[model samples]
Target: MSASVDIRSVSKSFGDVHALDGVSLAIAPGETLALLGHNGAGKTTLFRILLGFIEPNSGEALIDGLKAGCRQARRLISYLPENVAFPKTLTGREVVAFYAQLKGAAASEANAALEQVGLGEAASRRCGTYSKGMRQRLGLAQAIVGNPRILLLDEPTSGLDPLSRNDFYQLIAGLAEQGTSVLLSSHGLSELEARASRVAILRQGHLVADGPLAMLQRDARLPIRIRVKTKPADAETLHREFGGRRINGASVEVTCEPDEKMAILAALHQRPGAIADIEVIPPSLDEVYRHYSRANPDKEARS
Candidate 1:
């Protein structure tokens, strides 16, 4: 039941501040979209508007063609807020079971969901006793019940440890394999770099960039790092020919534009056996985020 999310010409304002200005984006089924922005950049406001918590000043948010928050849309959409809450008295199993019932699913389904999130051994533990990561996994279990068509997550992995965070993303990848669309807002740029199929960045409520990671990197025109390893005896010769900064006795690092990448590689072939090894690192997500943020600093200054 994977479904698409469409935000069309959406805008919102609070007094003298504009939270969103004609923001538009479409998330396809099975796609993972990472929403990037700083505090007060309208990321949360956009999520709120998409979930229909507040009305947009203009345009609309739709779930697979149905109006957001409508009976059909509600059935297909699920959400996990940045901060999760639960009844202190309820056991993990009970909490999942209770919420499943609310969503018209059975207790057995709850057990399966708990098991899916690696919480099977802790299903009987009381909510108050669960660790922060455990609570997050429980919240994820809640969001995915009934195989929701789309999942909206805000800072979903905020407090998770490295291992737990890896587990969380793996679970999400499996869900996407089953065609579940995901829209997650986060500050974890490096983490999201490889996971998100596309990224839509928000600055002061306006979308400043939207596309696949590679495309955005090219658009940013950021430098790509190229490193080559050679013998210490030939390091000077290679440096003279390749024109890059030498690292140790055997490596040199060169920063070049994307268009120059192929030409640089072609020249490397000329050295042949003289070069022992080489590596090229593209612009990181951090650099990509910084590029856009700097370009749109005007809005942040206004607020």
Candidate 2:
């Protein structure tokens, strides 16, 4: 079964610096929530609070309604840090087995965990001998050892190749299907577009946006780019007809509501042979981030 994570008005500070300020959000069971922000944002601090590595200065962090950092909360969660470190003297297999034993699983289960991350063949190799990507896989294997209900990953795809990244996402999708809630912090906005059910954007120490991807995009006032394909003359005519501005001779761009997308298509369809293709381009998360960041420079500069 999956567990939900609830953070309400959580604040954390280090000396005079505020790392997280009144952060509050809820991630439901079996959902994947992507955390986005620029460098120095509170992404790392938030993850640490969830993992019990740091105590919040105020408010609460809860897993399944239980206070975070309790034994019950620890048992239901796994964490994959941005940088994974393993004992140099230990073999990959030994490290995995050690974690399984700590989790009260039979040592024999380690091999299965290694296989799940496609590292079975290298299980006997010393941790010092593994490449960066291979070491990342080993860390992921350890996190998945007991099928914990909640998983927190920071830049999970870092150091992974294209194929490996694709496979990793597929694995995450399967975990969600099996009812494991995932919280992933990533800088790769494009990848999150397909992987995350919802995204929360953090600027400095504050959460500037939180909701489903579609909803966030809607609330961010993102522009939609429209394209119509036709002959140069027809394109020009259509551009004039619909007041479309030419991105090029054959392409036009417009900002409009998502629901109006079909209307644009219909307008072109009404004129037979006037259009060959139509496309609607939604704003990327990066663009949306810039929009908010620029609008609130002072707030975003605190961190």
Per-residue CA lDDT of model 1 for 194-267, tens digit only, reads: 67888878888888888898777777888899998886788888888879898977898888988899999999
* Model 1 residue 145 CA deviation in Å: 1.6
Best by lDDT: 1
| Per-model CA lDDT versus the true structure | 0.85, 0.83
Q: What is the lDDT of candidate 1?
A: 0.85
Per-candidate TM-scores read: 0.83, 0.83
Clashing pairs in 2: none
Please give the range of 10 consecutive residues that has the lowest summed lDDT in model 2: 294-303
